[model samples]
Target: MPTELRPLGVTCNIQCHYCYQNAQREAGNMGGNYDISKMLQTVDQVGMEFTLFGGEPLLLPLEDLERIWAWGKERFGKNSVQTNGTLITKEHIDLFKKYNVTVGISIDGDGELNDVRWCGNLEKTRTATSKTMSNIELLCESGIYPGIIVTLHRFNASKSRLPRLLLWLECLDELELKSCRVHLLEVETPMQRQLLALTADENIQSLLELYRLERELHHLKFDIFQEMRALLLGLDNKTTCIWNACDPMTTRAVQGVEGDGTMSNCGRVNKDGVDFSKASEQGYERYIGLYYASQEKNGCNGCRFFLMCKGQCPGTAIDNDWRNRSEQCSIWMRLFEEIESDLITQGYNPLSQHAVRAILERYLVQEWTKGANPNLLRLFLHSSATSYEREVMHAYLVENNISHKWSQGKLAHLDHHWEGE
Candidate 1:
């Protein structure tokens, strides 16, 4: 099913250094008025799952939220809100239950780790966080699962810091957290670059340490940590990693509605080439039409994982010099290889084989199903498919008469059938 993320362009109370929203912390007002009636009508027209995100969505008045929930329930069945958790109150919790809103809270970790950007008032954050914990408990008690979004920064990557974060989560009394998502801070703009810059060595070391701990916590009950562990252990290859940008299942069907109510293919690209204010003056549909018309001509044509990534976050692509592969791709590949080597050294033959098969199967499925465009497929196959087992794979394909082609750079197609399948 397609999912639509509607950015409310609202301001927030806290000033997080790494926030991508560019929200005004003091004014705490949305960029433009959010017309609930028009928004609901659009949701009904699209018939897609909707998510509310903002400078801080909770900053919106509770009555506005209630109206949203009522209209949303009549049109879209499920909805979610991503928030920083500082503004949650008992009334907010009740509204959540009334709307059946799935909650995702953004918190780095323990007081120390979380204090990195939650810097306005240490005592207030502590108080707010404690209250948020209670809210989470209330949600869980009410049978609503809540997820945590943790952003890893320079300090949180330290060997000592990671363990402490884990311990903190274990300590929370009401934290039956359903998931914990960890993401590296992406610094793209010059202003952002100045605000958040990490040395390459620091980044590498942090990733390595994170991967090590991830391996140690593989069987955790929560979803995020388990997924990270699986990724570290090489269990979450392209096939199993549902969030792999290449996987169609993980792709988000987003419509970017800007401050002035103009729509775009993706909100991430709202800052680029889109004149939302003008479009809003004209009509929302005009902007959407322009966006759809420009979609085919944009990025993802020559990408190796075009089928999988499908030009992820146009804003991210533009910000990162239009590179096809994301920064996380290299880290993931390195971690996978490291785990594979460790498995071999430990004499875990079956586990190592399974890891290898997972990687290969994903490659096979992508190439065979025409999931990846030919040029990208050729590069991946040529660079990685160079082993005795790979030769065996080619032989199997030939024997089975699979209607697939091999990369001409390294391996050539067999003229006749081979002995093995």
Candidate 2:
């Protein structure tokens, strides 16, 4: 849960057609309009890993940018920035080296493949991308290899187009670019009508192909594979945040600073022009109840991936209806199925009944209940788990001397009993 500082908020120079923040940015609502000194103080108070983000963070004044970099370097050993790479200059490259910043530049592909990332129009997009590639080359030549961030859409995610994109990535010889974060387009209300948005099926297709390509290219990494590989290898600690039951209300680890020095629930929480920080303050308690209620309502009863997926990203929950799982549910399910198959081939039983119980015990019983009182055993256990599976869980509990009383077809009064066991 890294802190993201959006100095300019949604006010970017280029308008990527599929951007979720377009509505806010189009309304001329730049976020960093708050008291800079207060914001800096807040940054110092919560000194940890900082991610400098923006409509475009580099669009901020060089002095302001330098202040942030200096603060991060002094407090934390390293920092990172996510930029479109259009505004980068030679001086900025030097500053990156000085602060040991990990630069993340957004680029879908070469020339025509990046048409959706527009700067006024197609011609401007071409020009901007050209300059972006040149800047990336310069970063690599200067021994600062920036990680590429590609937003997957119909424009660049086609089976035909992805190969070309991979080829180009490989051509960047001196670039020690290890990984790229592939963002499936965030299809919010405004982006629904955009032609660039990929359908759920298309999204699955693209990722399936990407996984195949990922296996071939050992040198270049994709973060999704990294997570999956970690999970498959039983190195769950290295898995991504997606695997964790990250309660947004409680954890709220993804903090965003509004332009007015107020804190937000992250950049995507509000897009209807309401100040998210203020809104969150007013309704945080209500939100906590709402989220928990949603989880109970949905009741991960039949979902085999409940432990690892935990209803997936709350940000993409259907219409922000936390009651439903993420809109990307189907895509993620398909990917997980593939990964599970691979893990089984390698002699790992990722989907074993024992594994499922472990997920429920750790994520649900421990994290949610804190071992004070046991709850949600009925909701956590998939209805599809065979009787043998139940026996396995019961036997394991008995062997470990964990006390529990079964009530109303649900396990209750669970406690670790060591005195009389």
Candidate 3:
């Protein structure tokens, strides 16, 4: 969990089309009158890792940035920030080490891939990307390796372009960049909706292939892949922040604070001066209840992945007109299939448990009808029914009213029910 502080609100130098906070900036809502002492007090009250965030947090005056960094380190013992990497300096790098600030730079990739994030003009964007990469190298030279955040878009998700993007990341890995967060482009604005070219299926397939390549190459690591792997190994609760006792309505796992010292839901919704936590209480709960119930009633009640996906990001779900699922549902489903198959290959049969089997029959099998892989089907069939398994299977069959008659010996005949797979 982190306390996300927006010191200057949405005032950034670069105009990234996909940025969700652009509306606030356009509305002249850049925060600058924040009372630092009170903000620090609120951050202390939260007692979590502090994150300095904004249109570009580094754009804040050097003294103010240093003061916030000092306070965060003194009170919370660690601090971090996400910046565009265009404004960083040698002095900032020094302060980063002094205050234990973990820097996360937002860059899509090298050249035109990154120039999509405009810097007022095409020529400026080209110049900025070069300087941004230079600053990244400087950070590495000073023994401070920064994490990269790549916001995936249609252009970057193409089969040819995706591998090239990976190669660029591999070069960064050589420069000692160790981590990256690969985010799917969220169509939050008209610009995003128009510019985003990749479909849900295309993005998922590209990302899944990227995961496999990363595994084979053993170079850089993606945060999403790590989380997925953690889920597969049953270490999800221990390793993943979002998976641990997260009641979305009440859980302030990531609290977004405004410049005027107001606490809000998160950065995306809060930049508009909305106190998201207070405003969304009833709305969030209602949406959650209705959405989950509908999913269960429709079939998800039987999905083992339900608990893991948890219907994806509630915000993203709402952004897509409260569709009862994440827009990235295709990506998540593919990821789970890969992870589950990997676990089986490693001799862990997730379906051996009656609980898993019961859930699988409800929706996992049916959902696979559209894109069932032959090899995965074999993995699903590999579980040998023990005496205990026989009892569980028989009970599941009767509870679901799956009419196939089953005795102790012909349990494997259940394959007939799963025809398309």
Candidate 4:
């Protein structure tokens, strides 16, 4: 659902005391006013292919991102952004290698473990995190491979600052920088949750030690434990957005757009910024009243991640109340019961397995109260599951031995999305 645009809305340069758009940039809502032909006609009437997000979308100008990446590389061939790599220059890495831009940045680990990214003090937050670790090592030595995020806090996941944030993620995996994303620090108050939060047992031990250094990394991949082992092996991994089923008033995994082009939700629930752009469709009526309210009323009753974490990410819900569930739901239920017991001790069957997770959690509580982001390998890939739910998911993948490999096509290239790490 990538469609960011946002000309300057929570406009930033540095002020990350755990910024979830800092109450819509302290209620004045930072910069604004746009029309570059209504932001390229809201990506040609939301036919979706956009990104250049912000609170710092390189604080716009470099000929306004060279006419927004030359009209997004002539209508979306290759272009994207999402920076905080403190105003990357050298002409913004030559307009991000001319347009094959993909870049993401937002660092939280490196010198001083990036001091809560607050640059109004502490020596301008270590000189803007040493110019964002030298523009993530010159945008990965100019080949331009960015995509790092790293938010977990307490000066970067403490326990002695998480072994220097895993030695700066092994120097961003020696700058080959495959992927990074970790973020659990969404704090925003009580002095950035007592100076940057991270204790649901230090957010499940810094995401189980970044999933045991992502099983001894070869080339840095932590889009949170490879998108939780690609959703417990159902794959189609859409690289983060809090394990799909987010809808803090219709977030639909980071949509934004505005500066004249309108359409917003997902300024991290705009806290109290007042329906930043409320286009209704009853965002799944609080995911059907928290799927039948019971966990002392914060519900997701008997949850085995209720069809891949639906009760999560309403911008860390709970007291922030996007109908409450994730105040980091006990560090994502202890990393989804430790990757569902390491994918059932490597034999697999973890679509949260109880006869295919009680028929996909009663058909995803009526397919997400009608908004639908449902797709567990498209329910055995055909008649969308109704030959008695594909005969109980092919008898629970033949009495649990499991790998039918999505009916032998070997997962025909699973492509779906959610967002974030």
Top candidate (lDDT):
4
Report the C-alpha lDDT of model 1 over 280-335, residue by residue, as the tens digit: 21112211222233334443333223233333333344345433334344443344
lDDT at residue 365 of model 1 (Cα atoms): 42
Error of 4 at 366 (Å): 3.6
Taken over the whole model, the C-alpha lDDT of each candidate is 0.50, 0.65, 0.65, 0.75
Better of 1 and 2 by lDDT: 2
Q: Provide the TM-score for each candidate, comma-separated.
A: 0.62, 0.79, 0.78, 0.32
User: What tens-digit string does per-residue lDDT give for candidate 4 at 27-123?
Assistant: 7767566677887787768767788887887777789888888888888778888888877988989888888788888888877888878889899
Cα lDDT tens digits, model 3, 100-191, are: 99999999988888866889998999899998999999998988889999988866767768877878877887886778888877666666
Per-residue error at 386 for model 4, in Å? 5.5
Candidate 2 lDDT over residue span 226-309, tens digit each = 665444333344445555444444335566765555566654444464544433322122222323444445444455555556
Error of 2 at 160 (Å): 4.1
**How many collisions per candidate?**
3, 4, 2, 6
Off by over 4 Å in 2: 26-28, 172-174, 190-194, 231-235, 248-251, 278-300, 352-366, 369-421
Which runs of model 4 end up more than 4 angstroms from their true locations? 1-14, 28-107, 110-112, 124-164, 168-181, 184-223, 233-241, 250-267, 275-282, 285-345, 349-362, 370-387, 397-421
Best-fitting candidate, measured by TM-score?
2
Please estimate how well model 1 matches the true structure, expressed as its whole-model Cα lDDT: 0.50
Give the per-residue Cα lDDT of candidate 1 at 160: 62
